[model samples]
Target chain A: MIKIAQLSCGTEYSSVQSEIEKAAFSVGGKMVYPDVGADDIDAAVKEFGFNPRSPQLKLMIARAVQLAKGVYDADAVFIATCFRCAEAALVRNELRRYIQEHTKLPVVTYSFTERMKSAQLLTRMEALVTIVSRKELLARERQTGLTAGLDSGSSTTKALVMKDNKIIGKAWMPSYDVVESATTVLNQALEQAGYKLKDLEAIGTTGYGRFTLGRHFDAKLVQEELTVNSKGAVWLADRQKGEATILDIGGMDNKAITVRDGVPDNFTMGGVCAGASGRFLEMTANRLKIDVTELGKLAEKGDWRNAKMNSYCSIFGIQDLVTSLGEGKAFEDVAAAACHSVAEQVYEQQLQEIDIRRPIIQVGGTSLISGLVKEVGSVLGEMPIVPPDSQYIGAVGGALLSSGFLM
Target chain B: MKKIFIDPPNSMILFDIVERLGHEPLSTMAALQERVDNLEIDMPPMNVTLDDVISGLKYAGIEVPSGIRGRLATWGPHIDEADAAIVMAEAPYSFGCVGCERSNEMVKYLLRRRGIPVLWVEYPGDKEAAMRMLEKTKEFLGGLE
Candidate 1:
């Protein structure tokens, strides 16, 4: 059997995995789905040495490392990309160059838009598999060892330890000081795994505070937070069967990532300088004297079809919300309107150009709020894939990077 | 004196008004003209570049060609220098070049993100709206002094 390892930017190709697998099987190629465990993410990062100032490019480097690992035993690799995504467009050449140089495996990249037909995709996959199967299978020679990945995000720090391609321990904490928070999580994971820091083969770091934490930990590699999130989303969703889009709504920023064949093809983000973000929701919830958790439930109960919040600016949105509430409008309706407003802003500002292919995988803390998910779903007209551990995806991807599951 | 960036930088009327008010009207065309004048090219080169193409996509969220970048580049220095902006929303649709819809949208978006005070007006269909817009533009620019 032709052993082909598949790697992608997780949520981008969530539902498309089955089609790829079918195409592989039809061509007498057995697909090797890498365990979503652990590998030396830091080592991978060091191998691809591009220090990008842009957060998106930085994350692409991190993801490139993981996807490169997926090429280890495969006859060929397929990278799903989105054409309109500025970050993906910027890093595409670099990623292809790294993979070709390091793995020497045949890599096939294609973009999937709503206009792309399944038959066309299957035909392309078949052709690639057929062409690559004639090549001799590469043997796997590396041994599994304990590795760790640390992700120090803007609001939290997460750590994961993997042994023999299996996740043994994971921990997270609210982040204040990057080093302290990272250390706390690392220690917690180490305790859970019953291993000393000295025993770990290598360490990788990612997230907003990656540079700081990498230095403090003397981390062997550093990855981008967005790439880690994409990797984690792919693993969590069990290799999405078709075109998948990852909508990660974080505390201050929102990201829309579309994956073609497990690689981020296109992506857009909001809230860099200003726009609606999770903090906006929190503030709005607080003003209504409701817990952030309750905003979703209230939205579900309210009939807010006509309630429109016109402003894309969070401050303006809040002002509108305040005025609406003061006008004796139903609190639930107003809450729903807030959710709708955010959804509209995301769609208009970020996703207006790209053709969003479903099933959309909703990740990040805000995704947990059912109201926001419902609002976003209504706007896209498709329910999103919300994993139980959505909030921990970034850290999980970081850990996975260390474990070799994601390279 | 305040520097005010005007959309449809080719609008001679808007440019004249800004000059009459004793403010510098920053226009994209002026920037291109300055570059052309400085270079003294035998033939006027296209104003666009790869940087503008990318910036149009990144900053303005519009897909445009290098040619459009040439025109957009003229507005950049003014955007940086301007104390305020006056946008005639329908100017591009009416009197200005309508070949690139994306470029038009991009210019508008860029102006909004400049974080400077901006006065947006419709292309006046009647004398009343035109007078109101003129008053608003003068008042807005006058305050910059």
Candidate 2:
């Protein structure tokens, strides 16, 4: 079994230690503390030229030092700290950077809460184990075999077929029925590719309905979006060998993931509300008496300051749009306000969870909305890369990873 | 009788409904009141001790403020005693912070970990959601014998 280094402060006091360990164990990973002596901690701290006030923080730094020096035995690192105090946060980030700089092992960091459960930590654990155990698969530069992937999203179902590193066929539609959507999208993709379902050598699935669809199709792989999306985004954008950040705003939540050389080491998903998601934009379009497709172009022509959409909750956001329109505001300006509201909330709430890196790749269906894309750009002060066929990210991600099974 | 734990312990509305349904309602107000009424070793405003606060470490981390820990200390045992739980999340429970929001999370987490029948609902912002919560709570409590 792969051993993942567990280095964190206050997990024991907070009583979330079992949850973390359980997550690792469930993913076929054994969580172990880097065995370091008291003398080793002091010497490493001195050499590292920093001292932490908390003894827990000091011990955490020492373990990181030992792992970085190759004196400790581990496959991957999981660094976590309770959501409190500036010093612990600094130590968490510093050690993560130090360890990554000194070693090739994948690392993931989390700011845990007292209410944290094993379910919340399982994906991160699974991703770390996937990275450590399947390093060669993630390192593959291209897809060689015929494979199919399905992304059973909350709002839509998407399917794609890839052959020899090329996406030959793809289809997507509203997810009215999970099973029906998956079957229809897959069949559509197969027909477009001029191939039968049995022609595909491997099948993979991802997204909210992944498990349900995976069971239906007898899929070769059922994976989470964190690992699969990063792999696919880098593959499509041709940034497979560099650092990048990925942003995907879905129907119910948003995701911000940071990648290094096509491997996801850090990612944050979900927000407090749906205001930072694609569903909010659809509501805005409905209120404006326009098609969702037309809202983007109309928004690009107006200024958001005129509408004053300051609400970060979905229900209140709809109220704001109605009040603005009720007072004789133009549709174009209101459209811009709606787009800007979603973008700003994504920036303020979700983006705060991860350190932003350049070449930001925005995926999912929301990426096609030029106004949403432009508003997000203005919020971040940099234009994002919306790769070709950005809407099929999950399907493409699933197809790409299933290629591993083919190998 | 089954003991049903209701979150937002200050919600007398929920408390009355739980009692009307013929089950013991385990809430923070009831627990704190029991301790406050006992004159053997406590005063009015301050009923719990340092040991109580430290015992909260069993459920929460030390980084959690002492105020939240003390509140959990009052509710923790009752959470363990519960036959079922009904949580009203993201609801406007009180005008003051009461640290209830955070402690409520810790309480709910404990309830989940205990592996009991849990009915989670959002605080109703409208008549429809309120009716839904009431109906769900009735079914949940009625089935808990």
Candidate 3:
């Protein structure tokens, strides 16, 4: 039986992986559905270089490196790309080139859109499986070991320690420097688990600062932000039998991920709009000269239904707040408006068209803010499942990847 | 010769029209490209750093950074240098690159604040509109020269 590795956005990975698995089984081939947690992040960054403008694109480059390393022992590789994702579209060709150059494995690419039918997906998967099976590839035994997953985000660094397929300890801290913060969080988790770094078999890193932390820690694996988030959401929600949409409002970006059977089925990310992110709330609170922690409480006291500040730009929105204040609008009202605006921005721009199933799982640090959560709930018409320790989902997923759970 | 700033800096038609009228065509894309080339640095389209956002807001005389400021900074230098301006109200929307609606509004706001002769043209949706646009654009460019 041929062993094939799959690479795709976390949102669509589960559904797409299932179809690929069905096809592979039919074609007498085995599928190696592992998260792209391979030790090639640094090499890929060196080869592709970095584009500071699109951090998402840089993550894709790192993913390509992971895939390159992943396919080293596999017979073939499959890359699934979301059709409307601009970042994915921009990086697809380069990712293919990198994988082809580094590995001799046959590579196949499929673009998935919301409009794509199941038959179309199955046909492509079947063809790829048929071709891969013809190569007579052999399956490798799964590796077993304790491992750690670290998430070094722009605002915070998180670390998770996993032993015997269970979370032993996890820690998170506000990030100042990538290396220092990541090490601090890792040490905390390690101390909780009563283990040293040498006790772990592998360390997988993810998130905005993943590349830097991966290098510093000599991590054995590095996964994309979306993939790690999806994995972590599934693990946290314990929704192994059902599908749920994961909404993550990070410091700089917002993501809406669709997960089915503990894997991402489809996902969409907010465009370059700070108003749709946590930064908007932070900036607005700063403009109001109020603490960010207090803004949520103030918003709870105001009438958000009547408070609508429709400015789509965060910079311009601050002016709106100032003008509202000058016009004798209550501070709580302005705070409420800011929260609603952020939620509305994300909903209208990113999640409006997505077919959101039941039980939306909200993750990321911003999810902890009551006002933002309430506003987002209003937009979705359903309360999102904001899991305890929601911000650590990505790191937990990274830990899961490190433990070779996805394999 | 007059220095006429053109919005939607990628519009070769407007650039040609301005140049044919014996005026210098100033555009944000040209200024930005010049800066990028001079530094021999690669800049992804629509990518803005916090510093770029701050500088753009500063250029626009706004004390805060924003998406508008970030975008305005790209063409603010050229806009500052121009003697007059021609704005395509619908051109940026057609190009599908001006993702920020506020930035689009800021361009017009900044141009008006410059206290220069500004020509506002709606991008043609039909042949009749196209003729009218060309005629109005020619009249505006001719007046500048």
Per-residue lDDT of model 3, residues A1-407, tens digit only: 77766655421211233444666565455666544333444456677765323322444566566556654466666665554545554465456556666775555555553233344444334434434442221111122467888988867789988776677889998888888998998999999999999888888888778778788888876655765677777677776557788999988777786655655444555546687788888888888898787888888777665555888898888888888888888888888899999888888776753557678999988887888888889888888888877888888777766666333
lDDT of each: 0.64, 0.81, 0.68
lDDT string for model 2 (A1-407, tens) is: 88999888766434466778888999899998998776676688787777875556778888999898889989999988866546677788788778877888778887776567778877778888888887777787688799998998888899999998999999999998888999999999999999999899988898878889999998988887778878888888888988899998988767888888888766767645788899999999887888888888999998999997989888999999999999999988999999999999999876765678888999888988899999999999998999998888888888888888874
RMSD of each: 18.3, 16.0, 15.6
Q: How big an interface RMSD has model 2?
A: 13.2
Clashes of each: 31, 1, 7
Position A324, candidate 1: lDDT: 87
In terms of lDDT, model 3 sits at 0.68
- Model 2 spans > 4 angstroms off: A36-53, A84-87, A350-353, B1-145
lDDT of 1 by residue, A26-70 (tens): 656665644422234334446676543333234445555655665
**Weakest 10 consecutive residues of candidate 2 chain A by summed lDDT:** A9-18
i-RMS for every candidate: 18.3, 13.2, 15.7
Across residues B60-95, which tens digit of lDDT does each residue of candidate 2 receive?
678775545656777788888888877777643241
TM per prediction: 0.51, 0.70, 0.51
